[model samples]
Target: MRMLINVPETVVADGLRGLAAAHPDLTVDVENRVIVRRDAPVAGQVALVSGGGSGHEPLHGGFVGPGMLSAACPGEVFTSPVPDQMARAAAAVDSGAGVLFIVKNYTGDVLNFDMAAELAEDEGVQVAKVLVNDDVAVTDSLYTAGRRGTGATLFVEKIAGAAAAEGQPLERVESIGRQVNENSRSFGVALSACTTPAKGSPTFELPDGELELGIGIHGEPGRERRPMMTSGEIADFAVNAIVEDMPPRNPVLALVNGMGATPLLELYGFNAEVQRALRERGVAVARTLVGNYVTSLDMAGASVTLCQADEELLRLWDAPVKTPALRWGM
Candidate 1:
């Protein structure tokens, strides 16, 4: 309830306005909350579109640029964007080459994006979809709903965007996206809950000196809660979960992502701990990225993502990217 804002109801709109102003190379559809690269469709390249709830900034929207997503639809805070919004984004970004939808494995996201894909197909636009379910905390198999997609979605965006930017066909880009999802795993812990602007209060209450382990991005109840532990212990818990699920046989791309309120210093400290844990497990770290790449509003938490990398995956990882949030080798 203690937030600073002139008009709370206008938070999403205001934030989008600011984002559009800050990045003129990107165009914002204020009505639909869809962000598209100013020069969209990129001619013959496969158009990439990914989206979800809004609070996780620098995600689908911040990632719209030359080597990332072609368009991103922002939903209401912590809620999935509706089907119409996604359909509009797909239509706007589709070129003759086709479009790819990178959907996280959230119930709302899956349902809405699926509807959009069906609508897009009816419009005669070729579309391919990949569902990311890389969170190891949730069990997955033929019967289960599959793991919740967390930090790995960012990796999918970066690598898949690179493939599409390289003029890969829609099928190839979709394949790359699926491959990334299949190889990646993530786990998270929350020290504190986040407050949604719309709700104007914390989503959940965590007592002092306690934390929630195996937390999902939507503030969903985690697997367990226990007294606060050292950074190393927390890192071990998360890394061990991922390592247990995905054995250390291949080189890995590591991402230590902050879930909003955690500072850079804390994230780096946690990253060091994660690196130590990986070293102990004999896992070779091919690349490490630490930042607020994927977040859960102001939640004081972090998630670790490991993408088991082969030579081809590593090559794609090194491919040039020019998104507003993730820019390298422009």
Candidate 2:
């Protein structure tokens, strides 16, 4: 497997340096591994913070900007960031209002963020934490005790960020973030495995001509592997899995996300099938966003995240956001 990097050891730091140079509006601390909006410490606003592992690009880091995350802490590939990193981010971005931590439900992430919240409180910074556990796959997986967090992290951040940016109280922002998580469901399918920088070979052995349904971001074992299915068939399986477990509300915010190596052409085609499947289920989509938002490095696969959005959630979702990976109404 070929990867573009000088070495495996410095991939995270090197990426941070590049991200800093590319987005001057963000305050990237390569040494500390915290990415913050240049104009942080927004007065009277509840600061929004989120993070996870490194493989999911354009996530916690690329999302640091206006109307999104106030700060992000990036850990090594598929590894959770330490508590110190999150505490530093919380302390740096927290103003008089407070800070809200958007944490994915992975065990390491949950434990580290919990400790970080305590550290922030010790530093006299009030903190609220929202745990995103929106994967509709397994109740307990190798990565998490309950449902693993997946694509709903984006929905949680954007909707909650909008609320925070608009001067909503910390309590309100935290409430909305949790609400978004509760209303969203995701299911992923992998066509190929992703290779981390530390390991040149594929992390998991996924035989060719087979697909893993309900795959996790870190390439964890999904529910089952079956012979490859067409785009429409995959869409039906993914969507049916989601709705059968939790039927979404009337209008939804649809996110057809690529797992990294999948091209836009295929993603767009999959998006069509997803929409058709949703229509067949009698689900109305308020807005549809298609692309690689929450990725798992260069894995040839895709995840479908449906967020049941109410009027308020839709308004917040449509708000202006100027992030590196996701930008709209800016």
Best by TM-score: 2
Clashes of each: 0, 0
Which ten residues in a row are the worst by lDDT in model 2? 133-142
Q: Judged by lDDT against the true structure, how good is candidate 2?
A: 0.94
lDDT at residue 59 of model 1 (Cα atoms):
87
Candidate 2 lDDT over 1-330, as tens digits, reads 689999999999999999999998999999999999999999989999898899999888988998999999999999999999999999999988999999999999999999999999999999999999888877888888999999999999999999999999999999999999999999999999999989888979889999999999998989999999999999999999999988767999999999999999999999999999999999999999999999999999999999999999999999999989988888
lDDT of 1 by residue, 122-230 (tens): 9988989999998887664222266888899988998888899889999999999999999999999999999887777788899989999988887777878999999
Candidate 1: which pairs clash?
none
Candidate 1 TM-score versus the reference: 0.96
Question: How big is the positional error of residue 61 in model 2, measured in Å on the Cα after superposition?
Answer: 0.6
* Estimated TM-score for each candidate: 0.96, 0.99
- Which lDDT value does model 2 have at 222? 92
